[model samples]
Target: MNTKPSSNRRLLAYALVYKYRIIAAILILCCAVVAELGGPYIIKTIIDGHLSLDEGDMTPVLALLGGYLGLLVLAGAANFSQSYLLQSTSLQIIKNMRMDLMRHVQRIPIRYFDNTPIGQIVSRIANDTEAIRDLFMSFMATFIVSILQLAGIYTALFILDYRLALFCLILPPIFVLIMYVHLKYSKGYITIMRARLSDMNATINESIAVMPIVQAFRREKKTLEEFEVLNEDRYVNQVKQFRVFSLSSRNAVGTIGALVTAMVVWYFGGNALDGAIRFGVFYIFIDYLGRIFNPIIGIFDQLTNAQRAFVAADKVFGIMDMEGVEVEDASSAKRPEGAVKFDNVSFGYKDGENVLKGISFEARKGETVALVGHTGSGKSSIMNLLLGFYEPGEGAITIDGRNVANTSKQELRKHMGIVLQDPFLFAGDIKFNVSLYNERISPEQVKQALRDVGASTFVEQLPGGYDEPVVERGSTLSAGQRQLISFARALAFDPAILILDEATASIDSETEGLIQRALKVVSEGRTTFVIAHRLSTIREADQILVLHRGEIVERGNHDTLMALGGRYYKMYQLQKGERVAV
Candidate 1:
């Protein structure tokens, strides 16, 4: 999206939601302006009306001086009130905008995240929103006040002398030309700067997350060099932006103002000497001239801020505009009976190349179906489809005779549970991790789940048992311990359909034996699918399907497949260390 009229309109709409606060701030600002404008007028009256008369009227001079001081005090107080109101209102608007952005992001499709960087998404939600907040808190308020002050100054100048007011109009067009040139060149550079910063953040996040790999390979120098390149790119763009600001912002406007001031003196000074102009009017015009140019310079300076804010708004709205996943109403959702079937399904992450081609499978309730394949043989793809993470490219996936493609993921996953190869744990107590903070799951249920998974053996030895603290990603826990907790988590949920994808691969032999016994109890009546690299783990499975490439080549019980002496027989032999000739 372009950072122009449309983006500006959307930003304004965000602020306009708090219209009453803005109105109050504007009213206070006007009062401040009145007090500010009174200062120069009072000084002009003292100099021209009283002091110039040479009547030795000390009383009038003292009264005007006292009034000037009072105006300054009033202006300060009003300015403070206006600033406080505007800042408070801006914060409220920012909070609302951020909340909406976060909610929108949560509803977006998983595919959006697949292609986008986490750092870029974070930058939009955090850094860019903060920039937009600065725009509202400072730039927007300052720009409005500056424009009003300029209008007031121009009105006073015209009332004092029409000729000078007409001459001042020529300077604005010149200022506009300079500002236009600056914006044209600086905007592209600013965009580059923001992009480079996001790239730097992404690199930092990736590097830190994989620090162990980098250190193990001793690649610190290479990583540092890569980071330096991104940093330098951002620095170069910043220098370019600074050059544009120096040439066309306050300094450029100030030069024009000086020339205008010189012209005023030459023309009006001669008129004053001939007594054609009142001294009081001359003083007012000169003071108003300074007032007018200061705000004009401020406006040009704030243009940079305006440019930044608009760019940020464009990025924020870009994400907000993306289409999100559809949500189904809970009242309309149907409960699956744990019987899953994939009928001639074909699929791929991208077009024109299928990962699972015309594959068919069924796992009835109370049955364990095991899938055996190489890494890319589409085992995980089947699970992704079963969980409604992706729809099949052709044919249908159904749970209890209801097509999964037509169902919302929330509804499809309600009765399903999955334990991945690499189990993840959030930072919390053991009980919280097992129950995932689900208040519906009682403390007794959480303890029972741990017992069911044989996790209580090690957990009970910990100081707090179920309440034992778990650090981030459960780093303090052993791999076997983490796996057991994940099993407990799935068991606690009590899903009707359970999937274990290499869930025991990383565990030690002793822990695997324990898990094997636990699995028997947990999979008692639930429909289960197991994807195993270790052939021994699925020996008791009711059905075994051997997949090669994207198609299943053999299917039967362990003894039946072994008797056939085909692919499964060769794989089992290889795992058992029997030398089978290629």
Candidate 2:
């Protein structure tokens, strides 16, 4: 998606559901304008009738006083309602936008995540959304109110005196021209400020996320220095923003002050001096004239805010508009059978550079296929493709002759289970993580899954057992414990196909033995694919494929490959030198 400034149409789409509230706001504005205009008219009535005449008109004067008081009260009530309706609508729109963005992010391909900066994605969801809130609350509603007030004031002024109304109208265009130029110049600078702010936020987020690693290396002082540089850049950008803002404010005030002065001298003075308009009438017009320009100035100031909001909205919408992973597949497509095939698969992130090239493989029902490769030799890519995280760029992958591309990802993945290098657990009880919305799985079944994975041993030792609280990303647990919990969770699902991508690499040999026993139960009667860095982990596999670069360089049973003494043999010898006892 092109990340350019979004137009008004996308913004309007957010407002459609709130149309009634917006219309209500407009009606309230109408009442407010009527009340505001009535105040001056009452003053004119009292001046032209009560003060000019004797005590005979005193009762009518009191009634006019009551009318003026009533109008002011009405204006207050209308303003209050308008504020509530507009603010309510804006907040709801923001809430819906956040939800949509989050859902869209979930549906997008994993490759998008691999290439995009996490900070930028974070900025779009958090900072940019906040900017949009500011625009809607501060600029959009205020701008609308200003326009209505200006229209009402000018109409009232015209009814009172056409020449004075014309004079008021003349100044707006000149001010608008000046405002247009000022906004044009400020737009680039504001864009720069916004980018700097996002960059700063991104840096801070990354630093805080890696705090454990930084502390482990004792790089606190170095990290602080790096943050200080980012902070300084943010400070410089903020200072520049303030300078531009001050200049714009001064220019607006100066221009409006000059116009108001001119209006008072040229129109109000002439009428008052010639007795064509009374003292009260002229003074009231002067008051309304000043009030009218308040909205105009407000409108001008909001232009800057509007530009910032547009850019922020554009970034947010850009993410939403991204081509997410294709989820559309006919319901008629059958659930894939227990067989996996990669037919001349070729894949890559970018043009002309294949990470997995012309690779063909198969895993028959109840077979264990092990993949051994160096880092970045497309082992994980194969796992990703198998799990439907990405689609092959060339050739097809299928399950029992049902092509993956012709199937819904959700449908395809229902039969699959995967344990990653690092497993993630949410902030909840251990039972909740294990259940994962599968209420059909009873506590007894959950216990069995945990027992099968040998996680029940430590889990039962915890204070609350399955009821124990897991903190954010399971930071409260050790790496081995997290993997054990993940294994239990995967087993609870009872998928037809199982994948282990370096699942035991982080655990010690002692835990690995427990996991090996657990895996024996988990892999029974299921198709299993294992990506192993440690050659010993896949020693019992029915078949092994040694990948070099992007192709399968060798494939055979473990004993057969070891006897041949190829790349796999060389890797095994290197592990032996490292004293990895197997």
Overall local distance difference test of candidate 2: 0.83
Best by TM-score: 1
CA lDDT, every model vs. true structure:
0.87, 0.83
Q: Over 4 Å off in model 2, which ranges?
A: 1-6, 50-57, 270-274, 326-335, 577-582
Q: List the residue pairs that clash in candidate 2.
A: none
TM-score of 1: 0.93
Question: Can you write out model 2's per-residue Cα lDDT over 1-582, one digit (the tens) per residue?
Answer: 756445578888888878988999999889988998889888886666535556565766787889899999999999999998999889999898888888899889887888776887888889898888888887988888988988888888888777777877777777677777777777776777677777777777777878889899998898788878867876776677666666766576667667677867785698698888777767777778778767876876777788788888878888888888655544454545578899999998787889999989888988889999898898988988888888789999989888988778888887688888899898998888887878667898888988888889999999999999999889989999999889888889888899998999888898899889888877888899999998888899988999989999999989999898788888888887854323
TM agreement with the true structure for every prediction: 0.93, 0.93
lDDT of 1 at 378: 92
lDDT of 1: 0.87
> Candidate 1, residues 32-117: lDDT per residue as tens digits?
88889889888878667645434665777888889999999999999999889889999999999999899899878776888888
